[model samples]
Target: MKNKILVLGATGNIGRPLVENLLARGEQVKAASRSGQDVLGAEGVVFDYFKPESFEQAFEDVNRAYIMLAAGYVQAKDLLIPLIEFAASRNIKVVLQTAFGVDADDAIPYRQVELALIQSGTPYVILRPNWFADNFHTFWKAGIDHGQLAIPAGDGKSSFIDVRDIAESAAAALRTEQFDGQAFNLTGPEAFSYAEAAQLLTEVIGKPISYNAIDDDTFIDMLTSAGVPADYAVFLSSIFYPVRQGWTSVITDDVATLTGKPPRSLKTYAQDHRQQLANS
Candidate 1:
C-alpha cells in the first residue's frame, strides 16, 4: 500500500517542495494549510492552528504527518500539544521541523513543543535545520536590492541549509522507519558570514551588494518600519544575537546522511538563483 502522509504548512517554503517530492516518489499526500489552497495536485485540506476542532478531520487516515508551526500564530504549546494528542490517539507518526540549538530543556518555545512531542509517546523525527539560504532571496531580497544586506548579525557565520534539502530529508524520513524517534540537526556543507554571503551574491548578481551589521534595536526598527509585526520582528532580530556570538557556525553531515547526497552549497544556491540576484 502507498503511504498516506499529511503535510502541514503545505504551501510554505519547505512544505511546498516536500509535497512535490513526496508526490514524485508516488506517495499519497494530503496537503494542509491555513488557506487549504490546492498544492501541486495533492488533496487540499483546510487547517488553521487557531482552530483545534479542524485538526481531527485533517488527521483522518493519515499514517504520518509533517508538522510545522506557522509563524505569527498562537502559542506553539497551545496549538501543538492538542494536535499531537490527536495524532497520538490516531496512531499517526509525526515528523517535526524544528530549529537548531533546541534541546529538551531549552527555553525556546519550539524546543518546548519538541519536548511535548517526544513525551507524547508517539513515534516522531525532529529535524533541526540551520538558517536557510533562501532567506537572502525571500527575507533579505529588499536589502540586497537596496545594495546592502543589513542585519543584526555582527560577524556571525551560519551553516545555512537549503529548504529543498530539508524537505527532501523530511520526505526520506516519512517514507521509511530508519529515522524514527531521531533528532537530526541539518546544515549546509559550509558556513559563511553575512558579509561573505553578501560578497557571493554580489559576484553572482554582478552588483555591489554589501552586508551592514546593525544593533538589535536598529534591526527591529527597520523590520517594524517595513510593516512587520512588533513581536515577530523582535523575535527575528533576537535570533541574530546568538549568531553574532558565533553560535551557529558549525557544518554537519546530517543532510547527506538522510538524503544520500551532500547538502547544496551557498555558491550553488547563489548560482541557481542568479537571475533573482541579477534582478535585485
Candidate 2:
C-alpha cells in the first residue's frame, strides 16, 4: 500500500476533499467509510466506529490518519477513544477534527478525546473549525428555501469557514510533521451575525432571505417537531450558546497559515455554490 494515509469519514464534507487533495499531491490514501465504498482513485476500506473489528484493515500499512467523528454522535468519546488508542499503539500520526469551541475540558466528550490524544505519547495535530458556511445549503437548506434563516444565535456572529479550507489544512497537517503537537483554530477572515449573513445571501443569491433569531426553547421545539431526536436537539441548541455569547466571532489566520492562501469569504462560498443556493 506504500504507507498510505487513512482518512476516516472519507465520503464526508472534509474527508472527500481531503482525499482528493492528497491524491492530487501524488500521495497514497486509504479512503474509509462505514460502507467501504470506493472513493475515486484511492483504496477503499470499511470502517465503522461502532464496530471495532473494522479498524484493522483500515489502519493496515497506514502511516498517518485524518480522524473526524461522524455528525450527531454526542457520545463521541465512546467511539473516538478506542480509535485513538489503536492508532497510537500502531505509532500512526493523527490529525483530528474537533468542534471549534471544544477545549481540554474533561466534561466535554470531544475534549476528553483531545486530552487522550495529547497524553497518548504519539504525534498528532488538532483542528478546531468554526461554523461551516455550507450549512446554508445542507443543514439549514429548508429554512433558506423558505426565505427564513432561523436559529438561536441571537445577535452574535461566527467567522464561518469553508470546508475546502479545512480539507487543505488537514492535508497539510497529515503530510508534514512540522504541525505535530500543535492545535489550530480554522476560521474565515470575517465574522457575521445571522442578520448580516442573511443580507449577504440575499445579495449573492438575488433573493430575499431573513434571519430570525429565536429563543432556545423555541429552537428546541422546532427541531423536536421536525423529528430530530430530543437529546441531539438539545445538544444542537447548546452549541448556539457560544454563538449567542460572541465566542464564535473570533477570526483567525490559521487557514492561511496552514494552506498558504486566505480562507474563502461568504460571498465566494455563496458564488461557488450558487446553483445550490438558487435551487434552495
RMSD of each: 1.5, 1.2
| Model 1, residue 26: C-alpha shift (Å) | 0.5
Q: In terms of lDDT, which candidate is strongest?
A: 2
**Model 2: how far is 216 from its true place, Å?**
1.4
Best by TM-score: 2
lDDT of 2 at 228: 88
Quote the positional error of residue 8 for candidate 2 in Å: 0.9
Tell me how many residue pairs clash in candidate 1.
0
User: In model 2, what is the error at residue 76, expressed in angstroms?
Assistant: 1.1
What is the per-residue lDDT of model 2 for residues 44-86, given as tens digits with 9 covering 90 to 100? 8999999989999899999899999977677788899999999
Candidate 2 displacement at residue 28 in angstroms? 0.9
